[model samples]
Target: MTKELETKGAAIQGADAGKYELSEEQKAHQQERILKQVAKELQLPLTKVKASVSLLDEGNTIPFIARYRKEMTGELDETQLRDIEERLQYLRNLEDRKLEVIRLIDEQGKLTDELRVAIEQAVKLQEVEDLYRPYRQKRKTRASVAKERGLEPLAIWIMTQPRQGSLEQEAAKYMDEDKQVHTSEDAVQGAMDIIAENLADDAKIRAWVRKYTQDQGIIATEAKDSEQESVYEMYYSYQEPVRKLPPHRTLAINRGEREEVLKVRLEVPAERIHDYIAKQIVKGESIVKSTLLLVIEDAYKRLIAPSIEREVRGELTEKAEEHAIRIFAENLRNLLLQAPIKGQVVLGVDPAFRTGCKLAIVDETGKMLYIDVVYPTPPNNKVAEAEAKVKAAIEKYGVQLIVIGNGTASRETEQFIADLIAKLKGRGLRYLIVNEAGASVYSASKLAQEEFPKLDVAERSAISIARRLQDPLAELVKIEPKAIGVGQYQHDVAQKHLDESLKAVVESAVNHVGVDLNTASPSLLSYVSGINGTIAKNIVKYREENGKFKDRKQLQKVPRLGAKTFEQCVGFMRISEGVSPLDNTPIHPESYEVVDRLFRELRLELDQLGSKGLKDKLQHADAEALATKLNVGVPTLRDILDSLQKPGRDPREELPLPIFRTDVLQIEDLTPGMQLQGTVRNVIDFGAFVDIGIKNDGLVHISQLSDTFVKHPMDVVSVGDTVTAWVLNVDLKKGRVGLTMKNPNKKQ
Candidate 1:
């Protein structure tokens, strides 16, 4: 370490430094050390990481880097690159604080080697205070003002054990009527107050107490009598150990305290803490020890206790917020990955009033087949005509499913479909009520307008409803994920953080399901590996201009799509009838040579190996055969074989189908204790909203989600999940339905 670093370390150790305090220099050096450590962890060359850090500190966005800096970061993915960016910002903030602290200490003219080292090594604000304790300003303190009266020698003599046998006799030598020390008892009492105040402000003692209180404190709160019947009634008599409180309970308690519904207290056993402080300060003397103990007690009661309590509460709140965010992130990942119900011919209905009902027919693959309008509701007064028109279209197009947008006149439209299905009971068909949260937004979108310029906005909405059922991942990706309504306090949370988190969810979902290179829209394709917006457009243009790509090699011809992009993304882009079988599986195209060698060694052709039986054979194949023939590990070869057997099978299909209802029920019709099957529409931190065929959704709070305590609503129910919940409370006036997931008959 340099002299500056050594000096900082000493300051941190609380060693007495000479008149020149080294605080300022130490803090600056400490910041430099943190930056170096962060840069090294990111595995970037020092220069490159430092340059990026400087740019970020000046305020640049992550999207700017992911798009523009291909060569700068060795093309790091968005996630890894953003992690480095966040850490850089944090370190820079720490550096700015260090500079400010150092400047303040230097101005005090108390800079020393030990003080400098302490400032440099300080990891937290608390540590900084402990080091600065000895030098901090004192107000009209008893000890300092007493010293001004020329009582230092007497105070020191008493503290050091006076040479005289009696402290009173020694104290009388310094006492005078002008100094206001008339009696020995009065003089001793005044001296004891000075000692007590000094002991209370001791930096080392305060630091140890702060740490102990944080580890052992319990935040206790009781409801005020006036607010005893409020929403926070349960928390009126609440007291929970800081470390043991669950995330939801912590948030609830804090919210209660903030609203003044509870009187909160942060308590710790102070007796044990006082004993520890006494050991450090009042070493061994009967008279001095008695005075020191009295001083320590006064100091704690007057100052230290209150400060420590506030700090502990702040730390607990921060910890709770962190845990809540982590839970939100996990739930979002699973909700986004819910299965896409594929390959169904659907009749989409966007119900309306003056415009009647806009109907659009889409093929099994989501291609628009036809569009029309029918008045199925009031003002038309011709229900017969509307019914005939819908039946004829369904028959003509062979529509296997009916998707009604949950918007205006949706209940009436749903009734029409249910009646139609009842009349044609022998016809194999199903109907679903699709959430239209962002359907209108998507219809007005530039991308949607470009895809359907000739169709009216109403018809575009119908098409969206149909497509959402066919592939929820692809359709939902067109709109911002936040607009999809699956987060808790999303708007209140950091906007940039929410966007990044949701984007990760979308990307992970898209890749998990895989995509068809030729048929996928550019919006969907952009999420695929190696395929950005420009290249995705190019791939679409190439397909439209020259027909479908016959093999993976043809992808190289797309504008601006290079060899490196192909290597990262080709295996994830599936082709239904490509020239090679591996083109349809997740096994990268580069691994084709290895598969071919394995095939030859087994005396089998690629066509014969496509059978399901071949998967079993490959699963049990010897490790030595794989190693000798393919020059790869058995594990790698086995993974490749498994991918080949499935050949683009979506992982999401393993989940249950989204629930679709035929009849709509109102809040008034729902009674307390009534059980109903509902589909989960969206998940938030506090609860999950279930669509029970009513225009409004019912809420199942985290506590009501299960008999056992749920950390999050998604722990038991996910987006599109069908759950059986009982109505716990129904407020018709407010149009609110409170539900419970736990079975009512089950024993507690």
Candidate 2:
């Protein structure tokens, strides 16, 4: 399997060259295979897969189909829709290739009924290639040269396994000086070469060997330079069964090998493979048995082993990369959806030392109210002066939250802010450390500069910090998704695959929360369903020139946003202060007739959509019968009912609120078994990094994630999760703290 994953970590293998070559009739047949494979793999209904695939092929975006066309897909969510799309592409490519290969083989006059059946039934690209191995065009190997010398007949004759004939003497009949067969020995050797190559190309044997290798192989590594002082020291003398190696370890070994820090190889029981091949090809005892035995040894060691090893290694790396990218995508989605500390004036501080901490104060609406710099840390150590400036801004803007970036000198700045806030203890102010992973990158980005042309990089970062506290999804969209640094070995994975998955995650989050049509930035608008970057820019321009949008229909007037784009994106774009209250809800324009009917038939008015009277009526309504009566899908009607209850609701509010701090704690304050609350900063395959009001985040290893069996850290925690963890170990020298989520009070 090629295992080329992109969005949603597609397990789509093979180059889809045949997708363009397939005829409509061929594609129609391929559709059945695709649907069945997808349904079986995802355990979704086959009918649902067919409908989802049809919607996808008609150019509908995933978020659009997931939200608006729920009935057609049996209420499959975005994730299920994307998976069907992934498998559909893979199976279509597989079918198209099967047809293309059949055409290629038939054109060469080698097609047969058995071969056709084998090709058609092949489930994976690897199987198809194996079946096509012998017929595939060759690069002048020993077999090809043997055919040139008329030794193929001799090789074919040897296959009958003459019970009592001298193999070399039988070969002597074909010896000719013109063909370079100087002796019977030379002719026999050439015949054996042909037999060896043919044995290596046998599809059935190749499949068996591939499976046996993986089941019995050991992946071993050793240091290339013993004294290199590398981070892969643990892998210096490592040995793991190929079947049991985890994704992270596989990626690590690949990186180590790439950096030339280690020499890695797969160790398998070669004798067993040789014996297996001998049994499959040698047949009964005969004069040719000894020669065929030699052929098996040559075919395996010289041809099959090397190629299988490379394929297995590629598969391992691909699987690992897919897992890592998925982790990154999930973490990023959770990070973006982090509950915003809304309705409060926030003071954002981009912590620094010599350059001074940059400060930005944003109001409840995220409008920048003030920007300044302070030098309360190191070098100048102007503590009192910095404190006065911050105090003036806080008192002037009535700031309720102090958001400090966890960067250089962040600990010192937090201490200073803690001291200052403590002095005004009754002001009802709180402070918290914000992850600054992508702040610097976003600050220097072209988008940031365009958004705030007058501000310097650090000053812009301060504003971003403040805005992130106000609304993470809106502010985070300004930066590239992968730059957020949420996963392990992100840089080592396939860059294109990682980019596609992360972008999808961002889109999913943006749509889930819904976008405000009037006040959204161009950066945020670009991720809304069908809106491209160009169309997003056009939207912002139109809004700036014409003022706020009164209705969602006004989006049609924007340049380059045609009817199709509008249809795909309108439901995700909400107008909170629009002329029509229906526009504020997720109810699609096409569903307006249904909503009007729901209200009219239920003896309700549009103004009373979310009122307790209507909500109660909706709560007890027969949704199934009502959906049929309204001529809409039950899922869509339910969604409309939901949207009507709480129009323009920000879904982030439902999640647990972010943890705020009133004081700072140094590493010295942590003790073993001390329970503390913290926010999960980043989650990887093995553990989660949590910010517990300290400089470095503490780690909750998968082992300590729970008292019961725990598989992955993500299963227990995600980024922005508020968890209570007990300190297990604190190493002041290394500035590391180990934590466990298991309650110490629970009896084992």
Candidate 3:
């Protein structure tokens, strides 16, 4: 409340009442309300959510709180904590906006008790905005003009309708030639305008109208040019209820509308909405009934309907974008967490027609040992020379795995590699097709240039491809997440939102898998829980200056890495081949004492971790009992025990490795009923695209995903999954292959 309002309210109440104050009470109530609301929304206990929010407020990263403060959060996963964190910020902002709205209204001397209370009680920003809409300043609106012409009294009298006499005469009393109210009819029209504006600005009325439209509205689309054929053909004559419209369809319609290929509109029931507004505003029959009816109709048609339609469309787009972002984030997580084909000397092949096939041989540690170009495809199809060059490079590097970029000329290059493998005797060489969706983007990036300034873009891309196979998380972190291409409709969604979500997914994946402290690049380290790009670079620079990180504790010595940063990051940065075995595990250093005590109780040395003796001893140990003895929470203690069993474990190790083959299959080789094992390249709303040792990845539609009904393709498959699928149809002309996970012989 403003100082003037506070004084006036105090004087109105009593001399002893003093200045009216509710700030402290309001703050406390809002904070408590936010806690309970977040708890109810997330379906977690209030205490656990409160604790998690407090921890979040205290600067704990989501990964750290989830991993170390499990007892406090009741073992809430990173996803839950992140949701709470986001909601916490939202509710806090809501409170701030409410106060600001109150102050703005108070400044105008229009903040009544009921209005202030409504603003304070509003839970969502939309509700607060609705309450503020009436008081918001207008620019020479019809209502404002009516008020200027002194017709507000006439409008108010019509609303009351106490007597049924001479409505025109009453309106004529307000008419003035000087103000452009030349006739009683003009006077009545101005009054009706006032009533229309009032009805339109009524917050409750607008809210109800919006809800009703969204619940019952139908979204209809028609092709701008019916005869034209386009990808949006399916939606050219589409109609779906607003409530039931799926996210993909919403995005498709939006894209079609943006491209001017489809005309779309929300089909609202006009008669029903008009009746609703009449019921809310109109009273008993009177002389002014027809006049008020005109106002209500004009209000609904001219003022409320258009504004509410925009809001409804915005709400739909917001929800659709959210769903799309969720799918993108989930798909990105799976792709980033894919199993790294570790310990392989791999050769990366970037295929092109005119530029030749770029080749780079990377050793097991991802160090580029050789870079060359092989012209294995037209127009300079040097098949034998390309074969000899690859053979020599493979022989010299002892390359066990070859990663071919699935881009232009990939099929011809694959055939060349397959033929070369056949000609070469007993080297046990195998090749895997790697998704090169963002390789060119990465190669042309500044970071890539800095990393490999001496090499051409294609050569650098080849090196990145090989490194991607070796350590997917490490190499993928170097590229922009959206550019990695594991998402659908990425370009259509809001870029800032998509970027934030993808970055969070990468952070979660990196923290979950943990990074090797000594060998991890700044790019990989930047995704660590509490580390930024600057600090990541500082850590790497420190490593280069001092030596390998002797232990995780040495991370503190890096410039700008403070105690909190170390606390949040150390557990996720493993130091294998370090001073202590616990340093190599996911166990935080704060719990090192607990691990030591457990080891002592088990009569085991730290070096004996992962040994048969340690495994046998811990195999039958009760986590609750051990937790009590170690003075730690059961979840953390259990995690400690699990980590002890598999020191230096990479969680990605358990995921399916990439599909490797000695030979490749042409698109023509695929036939119906032919079963082939393939890697799921990308999972989208409609289907999964799988790479089956061919140039074009085949699509496994959601209907053929299972014998049972599948709600989504992701429910049955994820990116990087290896599954056995049978060919459904092969279109050689279109270079398209359709596949199914179901049995080919099974009847539909």
Candidate 4:
């Protein structure tokens, strides 16, 4: 080695004397290059990918774009959009570290052309370390001590194989007593150890090992022999390759290791690894090749092996988390998109005993009509009075359906309604047990209090129950989805992640079912496109001050609701008396000109296009002719025509009626294997929860949801879906109701 090289290496070990920094511009350039490569890998348009990155950098939520900005994103779904967002964050972080590594090497005056090229091409931190391995500082090991003792020349001679004598004969020259040079064998062995340690710590060797292990590593765990009946029992005899292991199994194994219930180790086939490392070391038969081989073996044993094991395990765990989160987000979306049961005159009952059942009636629009109290269950002993009160309310309010809250004494209240129905032999009267998980929370909320100041807290709860049945999307938005009690281990997951995911579900559902601009509450309006809480409140206040909105143009008159907000949200906000009928449909105002031209081409007025016969004729019309005339697609033409036919049709009206039972009050009344009609309240990764007219919600675990294996519960049932479930087990003390959907014939 040269004297200059020695000095630079010393400076690197001492620090302060050698350190460099890159400019911000240099870092940004590197980031841009990396992003371009990622875009290529994903096969996304560069402009679109960059736009998504820019949005993420500014902390814009994904749900906002997926629902409102169809034109800007080319209508990317939530999954594709989120993938881009996650990748951008990772690439940015990698670029930052690259800049730091470059500066450190330049300061040490050790930045060679080869090193620079390696660092520039490195895509991960492990790759960067591999390039830096030869330059890093080291302690006074046997290799450095040998070099100091003047034995390095002999070692180098052997490594080079430069037409010399045998290795021992060559080493004799450096074996002077004054230098404390030992036997040729001892000197050569010490030299080999130094080389081995150096190779082991080399960044290149570590990176290679990591890649190999990630592809071939097997994670095995054995129980400690003490906790056989513990949480880790399933994983006690587990051994599986990292890549092949299922996500749930990975999480279970990791949790077991965290609790110290299992001893875990990652293993790879030895012969294959040894052969691969040998080839890298012995590229050709030079004297250095022999030393490099020893180094490779030493590195694997001492440094590379252990580090690679941990990295492989960590990567596996991260993959598991990503998979689990994706499943959860999907299920949440389906649950939120569940069809709402609209336009029903509902009688909401918040069932109780000592406090008596609180009943409130709501009209088809979810506005509270009347409030009353009745002791339907024990202690009051007023069954006849309760029956009379219910009948009178139903008759007076012209209630079509009864919505009983799924809370305390719910089944008893359901039975009371059943008896009242039989006594009156009423027509068009059906009672539903609503999933009232978060009703109590909503009743005591500040928003509820502000909306109904004159009514008691119990009465507000009844109103919430009625509103849920009338428009689930609007009312459910007031409470947190996790608190709505539909998910599994919701509390155990990351709170911010869960909240953001669930919020996206709610927003998507709200937009899917267009809101009534005239009658929607501020809370419901807030979820609409371009309308925030402040704007929603302003809209409601303006409507109250003035009259109902007669057209989309009136939205701009609301305070703080500008033209841009109106443009984005107006199409989603339906007006029955709008000047342009298209405003009531999901078709954007930007497409109104095209729609009007189509109407003119058909030789029909806009009003004449509202019938199914006219729509069918328009849909069958040639797309090529329309494209030639209006410069639009057959698809776009058809879409526009359909929107015109049924302007402001409530998509919720197409869904099945929510079935609620007026019998089977308690767990004691439920028998194992008994089939019952129930409504699915929430869906999670593990299972779906069904409200079977009982205070306790029944769990339909994913395994029981289908005869075949179900990866997720949402695949079977969604929120607000009426399903038939069989009672598997009923534990009243624990308040557990286990239900199953495994049998197709199980439903009543």
Candidate 5:
């Protein structure tokens, strides 16, 4: 490890010798400062943050450090560890930008000691860019042309407020026809232009003005064509303080601007900015005072105002994007970790209009046993035939649950299924509207092709929908997360940033509920800690060639899965029937000896691991004294005790289950103040869209989320929550249903 770091250090030195003046020692000190700053920012102890950063730098994954290296990191979770890692990368990038900007200025022969210190001390990329703006290269402008015509000295003289001479007379001495200074007035105008540009470029002045604008500016938007109707109708003639704008509104306004439906601009008070600039540049009483005043106004109106407006807008958009990504990540995490509907025979239906509806039946193990196509809606109108086919399939397969995709013609299909269920009342048949957001995307993917080569696209979609109900995490991992449709304005945000954030959420969810090693597909196994796509496929192939793995140690036999991969992923992959019972729990294999010692101290045999007597014994055991005796920390010992209590326990079982319906309702069936049970389909920034066995999903706005104040909709409900709500309003023309969780008429 030392040799590898030394080689890396040499490579950095060889690459950066000419571009930066800082030595290796100085760079190390700067890095140390950054680490301390990150610790302070996160309100974490310096020691834990430092140790976690070191582990990350050593190529250890976040899941590995979080699970296995608790003693070194003070038991920090994956969220905290990932935050430190991201902050570290950001600070390093900031340092690199500083060095590059310094090099650029030095190449221009304009480096000063004060400017160098300021650049090095900057904490944000915006501050560094503000510092570098003065020396940055520019195309030919009014200021540059004036500098070419020998008016820079005149501008500098006016800036000093020399009281001895007339400004126009001094400017006349520099006028020359050959250099395009045609007259005294022209030369004076050129000098003021130069002064205006300089005032515009001042780093300190720009910073002050930026802060003032952001704090005091009003973001105003107006409809470009007032006659045209749009979804952004509320924003047609809107003005709001920049500081008070919500993230969802910001994204909406940005989209409106991008689509050319509205024109948006930052409105700052001009006189205040002009006074601030004049106070900085113009002195008490001089002939050039008036000229300086004119320059300040021109500088602000022409150059600084437009530039600052763009910067402020960009900053707000960046913040809004970050907030949107955070909300999406949280929603995706909750949706992925939803409890699986296990041990049920399910029938999947993919609804369509022109094409026939696709149906697939899967047993308790999620294996497709039968598939067919039926047309029940639209032009074909074969309702009786479709009902007969579905009924036969359900009876033949003993399907108790029907999973219908909420896509085109879904309500019609649901009504037909509801009628069928009513006829076959004694069979205990129920239906659920499954979120099929990414099912089509997954069906068209290369992985889907590899998994179902003989099935068509729609057939694969039906299977995916069924499997999603059986196991959400395993099936959703096969598709990209952004296509899940739980976020607002997902398309407007930066795609790469959104993808990276959602990927981390998926990783956290996957590690939280360990995968079953023998039953997991390669698509699901690839998400395990330290297991990439290639290694996951290799494990599956090895499992196919040899039989089911009877022990966790058998992972070592798979090609490309070395000691490091095994150590990282073994804790997150479970073998239910493995030789050692600990292999099925969340405890790492390295701590098996500690577990053995624990069992020895408890006087329990290996075969008596999950018995009620063993659970009772562990319930009364002294964890603190046992930890001291076993040479392990309390956290590790507590984790071991937890594992022993419930072997192969899934954490998702603690969450609420999906709502199922025996009858279907339509949009016309909804009435104001009607109470109904529903399932949360998607939770966004403003509200949650709920599936209430209706054609149009109901919207529960953030205001109606609770009896008290709700900061966000997710705080009140989550995706897949079984909630009871009252209808607030209904717009039949628009097909929109408004529901509220707070029933005001009912007593508390």
Candidate 6:
């Protein structure tokens, strides 16, 4: 390692001590590379990718840029923008790591022109690491010891595979007692160690070996204790090819292994790997070929095999985690965007046993009208007494719908409510069971406490249940998106990735539905395009100190809300009684002038928006020609038209309402081929879990999702989807039910 070998790159690295600071020109070059690569991979135009990247770099939020900058991004949606954002971040990180790795290699006097170019041109971080492996500084190892004993030259000489060399004499030349080389055999072994490490660290060799192992390996699992029964009994003696293993099974096997209930192994094709290594390291019948063959075997067994197995396993886990995060994100988006049962007075029941069921009545606007507790199950089954209080509250609060929390004692409470509604006969009342997955988490949250300090946890939960029936997105936003429990293997996946994906899903949904600025809580407001938690709280504080915001422009007066924040968030904040009706619409303030001009061009009053006259004109308006006349792009003009047509509209309202039931069913009552309607509570990679008025949600396996082959469960169904499913089987003792979405009577 000579200091004089240091070059210009090394000098720069030394100046900053490996700070990874790229100059302006370097950053620009890197960004251009990243944008071009993202565009190619995503199949988007390079110009569009560049425009979107520039917007993102300028601090424009994904939701804002997606909704408002369609002209610039060629109509890219939120999903595309987020994909671009993720790619840019990963490539930037890769570029930074490459610079750092290059500096480290150059400092060690090992950086060559080919290696430097390889590192710079690498697209993935793993590739950079692989290229740097041979030059990387090492801890104590057999190879390091061999190098210390001056055996590297002999190793290199043997690698040349000389046709006429004396193996014994060559090995004897390295015999020295001072540095642990005492005999010809010891010298031979030291040279073999050096050669083995060299082969193992070669980038191309490792890459080829890793791919071969991953393609041909089989994942095998067996019981750690065979006699112990477990949910993973099917995996007791299971083996599946790595290429054929599904993501959900991967997560399940990983979890079982983690819990020590199963022993797992990767059964790789050892003979093929050995042959390939021999082919690479050995030539036709050289003098050192026999000794080098032994070196290959030792290297693979001691170094390469284990490393390749771990890399394949890590790759499997990373892919599985990514798949799980995607599933969770899609499910969460659908769950959060479930159609709200608006304009209905709701009675919420939080069922329990000895502690009693908590009841809360909310008006059509989601304001709490009443709250109390009644025991209708088990130890404190106050059937008639509970019915009277519920009936009286229904009458006093004009409750039209009842929402029961699907939690402890839910079935018993549901039966009680069914009987009570039966006694009422034609009272125009109905009850629906709602998934209360995060009600407990929300009840104990600080936001819940601040909203209802005088109420107990269960009471707060009841209110949440009632309010969610009114507006799922608004009420559910108060809880963490992951806690909503719409995901499969959420706890087993990479937590940071899942959290980031779910956060983006929530933000996308919140902006899509548009929040009522005057009424949205800090949680919902924080998810709006540019608002953070602090700004959200400040907006609320400002509202409380002054009053309901009567105009959109008043948002500028709030502390910490500047021009950028206002620009990003204002379009998604709606006010029902704002100074301008456009404030209640999604129309951005910047487009107000064009809209007024549009109204003038149509010869319609501003109040005529959403009226028949505006609809008639919009139906006849030529978007392309009108946009040219209006000096605006067609996409922007079309968006303006859509927003004007549906002022203060919720995108969720267009979806089918959740299935409401006035009765309950038990697992014992489910019979094979018996058809029933249900709502999909969660979708996983394997299938969808449907709520069919039973204690446990029925599982519709992937095979039964459709008659045709289904690629994934999400392609067939999502969270909050309504479908007709037939009961396939029921395990009475285990309280499990299986369902099929295929019709039994349909002919093949």
- lDDT-wise, the better of 3 and 5 is 5
**lDDT scores for all predictions?**
0.73, 0.88, 0.87, 0.73, 0.88, 0.89
Better of 2 and 6 by TM-score: 6
Model 4: pairs clashing at backbone N, Cα or C within 3 Å:
130-203, 130-204, 159-287, 159-288, 160-287, 196-295, 200-299, 411-665, 432-660
Which pairs, if any, clash in model 6? none
lDDT of 2: 0.88
Predicted candidate 2 versus true structure: per-residue lDDT over 632-722, tens digit per residue: 7899998988888888788899999889899999999999999999999999888889888878999999999987787888778889999
lDDT of 1 by residue, 188-283 (tens): 666766666566667677788888887788878787785457878877777778777766676777787777788888788989987887787665
Q: Residue-wise lDDT of candidate 4 within 1-748, one digit each (tens)?
A: 1111222322123344334434688757866786797688788887777777776565445655555454466666666787787566555555555555666787788888877877877776567656766666777877777777776666555545454356666666667676677677667766666566556666756666777787888888899885468977767888888778876677777777777888898888866776787776565665356556666666676666886777676666656665565565555555555566666788999999889999899988787889999997987858988888888888888888888887888777778888887676646687877778788888888998898999888999999988877777778788777677655445445566667667666766777777888878888788876678999999999999998888777888899988767766876788776676766787767678897788788777777656777777776777668867998755555556667767778776777776655445677888888988888776756787787777767999888898777766766777767888899988978889999876646354
Question: Quick one: best TM-score, which candidate?
Answer: 5
Clashing pairs in 3: none
Hey, what RMSD does candidate 5 come out at?
A: 3.5
RMSD of each: 9.4, 3.4, 4.6, 8.1, 3.5, 3.8
After superposition, candidate 4 runs with Cα above 4 Å error: 1-115, 123-203, 211-241, 252-313, 351-358, 371-392, 407-424, 440-446, 452-459, 557-564, 633-635, 665-748
lDDT of 5 by residue, 1-748 (tens): 1111222222223354565756899988987999999999999999999999999987788988987888899999998998999788777777777777777788788999999999999988778888888898999999999999999998888889877778778878988989989888988999888988888899889999999999999999999998898998998899999989888899999999999999998999999989888788777888778878888889999999999999888888888988899988888998899999999999999999889789999999999999999998888989889989998998898998999998988888888888889999899999888889999999999999998999999999999999889999999999999999888789999888899899989988998899999999998888888999999999999899998998898999999999988988988889999888888999998898998888888889878878999999999989999999999998888888988899989999999888889887878888899999998878888889988877878999999998899988878887778899999999999999999999868797
Tens digits of lDDT, candidate 6, 1-748: 0011122123244675635577789878888888899998899999999999999999999999998999999999988998898777777667767787888887787889999899999886678778989888789999999999999988898888999969789889888889889988888898899999989998988988888887888999999999998999999999999999988899999999999999999998778888988888777889988888899889888998888888787778888888888988898889899999988999999999999999999888888889899987989878888888888988888889999999989999999998898888888788899989899999999999999999999999999998888999999899988899888788997676788889999999999999998889999999999999999999999999999999999999999999999999999999999789999999999999999888888787779877987888887788898898989989999999888888878899899998877777878787899999999998887788999999889999999999999998888998899999999999998888999999999988
lDDT of 3 by residue, 1-748 (tens): 1111222222123343233334688658878998998888888899999999889988988988989899998999999998998777777667666766776677688999999889888877778888988888889999899999999999899999655689988988987899999999999999999999999989999989999999999999999999999999998888999999988888999999999999998899888988888888678788887887788889988999889988888888878888888988998899989998878899999999998999999888999899999898999999989888888888888989888888989888888888888887698888888888888998999999989999989999999999989898899898899999888899998887789889999999999999999999888999898999999999989999999887888888899999999999999988878888789999999999998899898788987888988888888789998888878899998998899888888988999887889887888888899999999988888889998988778999999899999999888899889999999999998899999999867777
Model 3 misplaced regions, further than 4 Å: 1-25, 746-748
Model 2 misplaced regions, further than 4 Å:
2-27, 138-154, 165-190
| Residue 550 miss distance in model 5 (angstroms) | 2.1
